[model samples]
Target chain A: MTNAPIFERMALIGIGLIGSSLAQAARQRGLVKEIAISTRSEATLRRAEELGLGDSYSVDAAVAVEGADLVILCVPVGANEAIAKWIAPALKKGAILTDAGSTKGSVVAQVAPHVPEGVHFIPGHPIAGTEQSGPDAGFPTLFDQRWCILTPPENTDPDALEKLKAFWQGCGSDVDLMDPKHHDLVLAIVSHLPHVIAYNIVGTADDLEAVTKSEVIKYSASGFRDFTRLAASDPIMWRDVCLNNKDAILEMLARFSEDLSALQRAIRWGDGDKLFEMFTRTRSIRRSIIEAGQETDAPDFGRHSGD
Target chain B: MTNAPIFERMALIGIGLIGSSLAQAARQRGLVKEIAISTRSEATLRRAEELGLGDSYSVDAAVAVEGADLVILCVPVGANEAIAKWIAPALKKGAILTDAGSTKGSVVAQVAPHVPEGVHFIPGHPIAGTEQSGPDAGFPTLFDQRWCILTPPENTDPDALEKLKAFWQGCGSDVDLMDPKHHDLVLAIVSHLPHVIAYNIVGTADDLEAVTKSEVIKYSASGFRDFTRLAASDPIMWRDVCLNNKDAILEMLARFSEDLSALQRAIRWGDGDKLFEMFTRTRSIRRSIIEAGQETDAPDFGRHSGD
Candidate 1:
């Protein structure tokens, strides 16, 4: 745990999963002296206040950002523009402004124009979250051992970027800097496309007439249950991700579909060797992920995975 | 744990994940007295014996099944036909013969012709497995709380079917009966399609030119890690499943592709509401699975997940 505060005062624009998690993690590590949480929903604002996730809570984004040296937008990508405009007037000079959106390009474009001259704007995405959302769904350890990618504009202050890196490090994340567009592309394959595929398959299963929805749930332990976890993610967040990362997501989806067509063709043609070879090659990638410390070496992704 | 042995001598035809797990679960639960393990590969049979997975081991299927009251063909679906013909002469008259194959219709069609008049041929599939394979991957608790679907022939004797049900129950499985065709359709959606999708996406990531494989591996915790587990499953087992259950798998794949195209269109058109609706509907299915006890209520499918 950190012993010294990195930021004197921090303001969070949304009190959802990422926001609440950041609050909890930062508070536990003493990364910030004061956390001012603000959200559009009054109910959610009250809930965050009750959870004591921050030193102060308000429904006004501008009010929360006043006097804060650090302002982080933790809302869906679609909501970043409005919040940026709303808080632009109250943003403290020299405050490091950042975001935890899934798509960095869209978030940077949406929020960059409104940042004050002295405020440093850096776009970031912490590649960690569960299927659940909301204030109660967060915990202090959500960011532990996770990768946080930073996408700062070329003219941004180096000192501010380094401080933001250290702040995420204090929250237990390893930060890597990259171009916003490149981050969008890498994340399209690694996160956005995977979520789309999961949501698609779950929808397909729900529409099946030959197999009842009940049977899908009953025998879901087979494999479908794994997809359900990703499918159950917050709809608004995912919807924003899909709409914001459209081009990159579609490019990845096109490539994925082409590969899937080949796979489907091999299955249709009774090409056992092709199927066997492809399946064999994919197995090594999983081993590489496990060896890279991105995945557990636990067999079946661990015993708690419904057998 | 069961104290009484259900069968005097039980023979397993292959020593892979399913075969080894059955041996361990049966022995721990006292469901079988003398376990006889067999495989075409001398190495696997030796490994099974090295793991003390059986009372006896043989590379010859006929030799292993001799005088066994319970014979389970645990080989890949494509090998079931040949193994059935080879072991037909050695199976005991009143023995309960079954299988742990993924595709039941093909298993029945290929192996049913070789079953003798007095021998009871009740094909079954224990819907329990880990991504790992081979004799060393087996554990006694693998079958606990998992489903085991039995696809007995229409003319099967009641007493023998009941006995096989008891044997599986002793090993800690909830048994369900269904037609061979119906089982294939249910499994195509629940197990086979998910595996195919998982394999395809992992292959897509591996073939990308812009994103380095290391980048994908480093940030896999985002979403790609979940698919890797299913994609890492045994190649031969999955290949045989694809070939044997081609029609049902193709049907499910077609449905899945159609649904995915609509999702792609929604993203391309910036239809956030449509995407939101689909994501929301899929979330309820995951909740239903958890309520049905098929998934853990633990956020992110339990904390053991490598996030």
Candidate 2:
């Protein structure tokens, strides 16, 4: 671990999976001299303290960010507006205010309103997460080799942006900048849609009249288990993502439903050629993802311990 | 490895993922004294031989099954009829014939007519596979802790069924038995629909106007990558599954689409409670799958190296 801190002090609001993981990663690498952790729930704040995630813990979001040079809003997208209002008064001058929310447009819409005179408001999303949530589910290496996309507004201070990039890099992430709208669209297709689809499929399986739930669980290794992981993500977090990123997710859902309809027609008509083509083409995308090092080459999504 | 073989000789037709994995597992555990591997492709036959997956190799299914006490048809479901016809005459009179096809109902319908008298026709599906296929992809422990479901005809010889069960157990799979139709319905929800949805979503993302394909690959760790693994599964195998198990797949697909539509409506209406309820329920189902010992408890589906 480095002896010197990247920032004098850092504050993390809402110490769940992403927030707790950031704390661990930052602390492990000595990214911050002093860490302040806060959550709306006193129980979670106490739990974060018990985990030794930060040097100080508080239930007041404003109190946590009072002296911190960096403040990360780790709450759900829907809570951004309220948290922003509560903490706006306490944000130190020139502090880099950022968020680790899934949806950037909503974060911008919700929090950009109360931006203090000099604080840098940069919205970011690390392209990393486990289905699990809460502080206990987090670890230091969660962001390793993952992409962290930043959506900074125009006319923002580049120096502050560079510093934020360095901090994410220090935390084991590759940084990329994208427009907030583009970030939402890309994430909608890549993350939000996938989660919604997974939740729906599992729900469908659960509601099956002929196939029992036990059978679904027993036979899940046949592919159903993969979706269940994403479906098992934090309900409140996902609910906020759905509500806050409504338009982008709904748009992707429409495209997905459209493509599904065409595929359904192919299956209904026994168009083996079409089915084969679609199935074969999609295989290459997985290969591309592997080649790009975005995914493990280990077969079966690396779920099985065996090769 | 055990010195005593479970069977005198075993024949494997179609040396792909299932066939090759069976060869390695069976040979490693001494489940069969001699293994004969057959594929329609001479190149694959040579590759299987190169991998040392069997004691002998052949292109002719008939030649492969000759004198073997057990024969497992590992080809796609659509090819069952022709292969059964080709190998029926050469099968040993009391040989136990089975399959590892995903769809049991179609396998029984297609292969039963060609079975010679005194032969046991038990259809089975080992709910174990990786995205990668072919001779080189096989590993000895592919079936470890996985379920191998058997769907036997009402008149299937008990001794032969027991022998097959023992062989799977030797290969490290828990065995379950169900009626062939029930197996089809269960797999329709657990296997077929998941693959179809994966393929559809990848197609949807591929056809996106705003998001580039590279963006999808780069940000895949967000969630889309999970679906891609299933989408990368062997095209021929999945295509045949869709064709052979049409009705059940269609039914499941309908259910899935209906559920997805309702979820979409909830998202549009900003029904956070509805979304939260659905998401929470699905999380417990994932826990059920983990508790049932069908899935790994590692978060992020154990994709990440760190917990």
Candidate 3:
């Protein structure tokens, strides 16, 4: 058993779903000796304190970062620069700083300039979350068996990168290292595009005057209910995701739209073969995801939970 | 107690997910006196027999429907025409014939020509399903609290319609009667378009070269897995749904694409207000679905068993 404490004092600059989850996971596994929590609002900070999420809680980022060996900014991507500037003076000289933002390139660009000389600034994204938000909506198992991608600036301390990797591994995630730009591109295709599509489709269903709102709700179990969950995610967080990752999202959207047009044409022409071929190809991916243990094999939302 | 037997003998032609669920529901509730099961393959018929799903099993639809008081065709939409022709000669006099097909307009056109003079041909769709298929992928509660929409042709007998409505009610679903064209339009936006969108997005994620296939699977809990469940549904069934409901699906697809493009433009121009406004409005529809008992209010895929 490795008894190395990843951090003596860890500062979590935002105590929302991701931040609280990280704090819980670290606390449960004894990965940190003490954890300090901070957020913009006193209400959320008080809630985090009430939940016993950290050893100390404060509304000031600088106060939270004092004497911390590792500092993680778990705020929205758009808030990185301000938080980084606010906490820069109090950050320990040799401490490693990272983020759990969805978009990496923008986060790095916003935070790198504010970092002090000796602090290692590495931006990371733990590609895991629930549709819920806030301090109360977190659990230690949230990151279990999930992927945590780290994007370190070139020529930064290799020792700091490995330490961060060890920390994430202790929290029960597989660590992956990639260039910030590549990470942004990949997430834009896999994560951001899907969310944008889901929001748009739900909006489309809501605007339909012919289909009574009651009818849509009644029959949503067929397929539309799945999209509703994603569409119901935090609007501000998603808006930041879209605005920060514009180029890759736009590129993926263009490709998706082109493919959709082909599908529409096939439907219009009654080309059953084309539609069948496309639908058939998509099924194999789901199987692969299941086989990889990324999803439950239970049929229909695992309705047979007791049996 | 009202103990009127809905039908002396009911022939269910196609013992798959929906068909078998109806068999179980009917058997458990004593809705039908006898059920004659028929499918294209002998193996599925044997499985259905082993599961005690019906009283008798047959590979021939004609043999299965002989002397039956009511016939419910539960095959894929693409097979409706062929099954209709096969069972036309054996349907009993004054029997009510209906289908549980997902698409209404196409099934009506395909099955109407083969209906005998004394038979009442009504088309219905039970808007409920799980991602599983085959005989074992069914349960007694599949139809409970679901909407069962029926589309009867003009000049159809009232007694026949009333009997069918009573039969569905006994199986635990409230029945709605509407025109076939209108049913097609309502389902196009609610069901067909959502499934197609899910399949397309899953396909897009699978095709991404930047994101390793494993990464997509590892991080799927971040909204992508929800789409995978819908995409994993029976490919043949969805293909037929797209082909059978062509015009309405095409119109919905067009509207969805237009809305998606406008959202894409908003993101490109950094219009956070537009994105936030749209995302916020879509959340209420999800709330309405929960209020209507179509979905659970449990957050994050209902990870918590009780909310």
Q: In candidate 3, which residue pairs get closer than 3 Å at backbone N, Cα or C atoms, i.e. clash? A: none
Candidate 2 vs candidate 3, lDDT winner: 2
Off by over 4 Å in 2: none
* Model 3 misplacement above 4 A: A1-4, A303-307, B1-4, B303-307
lDDT of 2 by residue, A1-307 (tens): 7746779899999999999999999999988889999998988888998999999998999999998999999988889999999999999999999999999999999899998999999999999999888989889999998999999999889999998999999999999999999999999999999999999999999898888898899889899999999999989999999998899999999999988999988899999999999998898898899898888888876666633
TM-score of chain B of 3: 0.98
Top of the candidates by TM-score? 1
- As for lDDT, the candidate ahead, 1 or 2, is 1
Candidate 3 per-residue C-alpha lDDT over B118-231 given as tens digits, one digit per residue, 9 for 90 to 100: 999999999899887899998888888889999999998999999999999998898999999989999998889988998888887877777788777767766777888888
Q: Interface RMSD, candidate 2?
A: 0.9
lDDT of 1 by residue, B169-206 (tens): 88888999999999999999999999999999999999
Model 3 error, position B91 (Å) = 0.9
For all candidates, state DockQ relative to the true structure: 0.87, 0.87, 0.74
Any idea what lDDT model 1 has? 0.92
lDDT (Cα, 0-100) at B262 in candidate 1: 95
Best by lDDT: 1
lDDT of model 3 at residue A29? Answer: 89
Looking at candidate 1 chain B, the ten consecutive residues that score lowest on lDDT are: B298-307
The alpha-carbon lDDT assigned to residue A20 of candidate 3 equals 96
